[model samples]
Target: MDLTGYPTDFVADLGFPGAARRFLERRARHWPRLFLNGVPLDDTALGGWQLPEEPDTSESSILGFARDAAMEQHWEDEGYALDDTGEGPFALFYSRYGRPLRAGAITGVAGVPEQVAESVESIGLMLSGFFVVSLLTPDDPATDPFSESVLRDLRESFAE
Candidate 1:
């Protein structure tokens, strides 16, 4: 959660095949909530908030709508942009505004608890360049020891 310790320059390394999955597998449980490209990974994390149905959109397009809605919630200011090259599921993940999403912005999303939103910070990763994985973690390492520890762990794992 602490950006001071995050290796922002190495963010693109996360796009390596299986890197995102391994990272999530080891650290996702420590997060209050997780999202994939703006879509909540766990519906319960939203406290039962359901995506509103669009009158003209079909069921199949609901996922896209959900992604857009979620992105609009916090990504309006500064967020990572993933450039999908459509070449074997590899995309480039880079900061659009050179900063992470703020807690105030994350709280604006429907169903996110205030405490959870305030206590957590946002981190985005590109999964094999196919999709984006966003994680909400504690803002301080002291609040959640595992939060800071994972940065080192991930860097080592990714290096391999």
Candidate 2:
């Protein structure tokens, strides 16, 4: 999938800061690949990916989710985790199949690419993949389009 339009759409939907916006815009050229257990993620594995019962945002809610023993166990069982920095404001979404996905950029951190690398290394399997549309020098590929409902809710949250 051509994610050429994702950064623009994400900014339009979430009004992300300039840094995050720049990251996605700069990285849109790459392709996203979902990985599981250090391998390519597939539909069968995605089948186990689940959306939270209620609306959630990565910055505010997903930390709790990622840290939850039960949720962590579930993601471990599925061989992946949509990791969050517990710092940057990430927008969370579900795939059409209901698999959790995340998009965001981190800025103001010196040596950001290295920073993201360190974060990923620390989390290990807790992070499955990075969005191709990202700030990193070479972002991940296009895995799947984000869920419309999640985008809508994010927009609405901004409105409120």
Q: Name the best candidate (by lDDT).
A: 1
Candidate 1 lDDT, 1-160, residue by residue in tens: 2122212223232243345445444333544344444555563534443323323221222111112343334333323222122101011232212233222332232234776665643533223322222322222334444434644444444545
Clashes of 1: 1
Q: Model 2 segments beyond 4 Å from truth? A: 1-9, 12-67, 79-149
- What alpha-carbon RMSD in Å does predicted model 1 have with respect to the real structure? 18.7
Worst 10 residues of 1 by lDDT: 83-92
Tell me the lDDT of candidate 2. Answer: 0.29
Q: What lDDT would each prediction earn against the true structure?
A: 0.33, 0.29
TM-score of each: 0.29, 0.22
Instruction: Score candidate 1 by TM-score against the native.
Output: 0.29
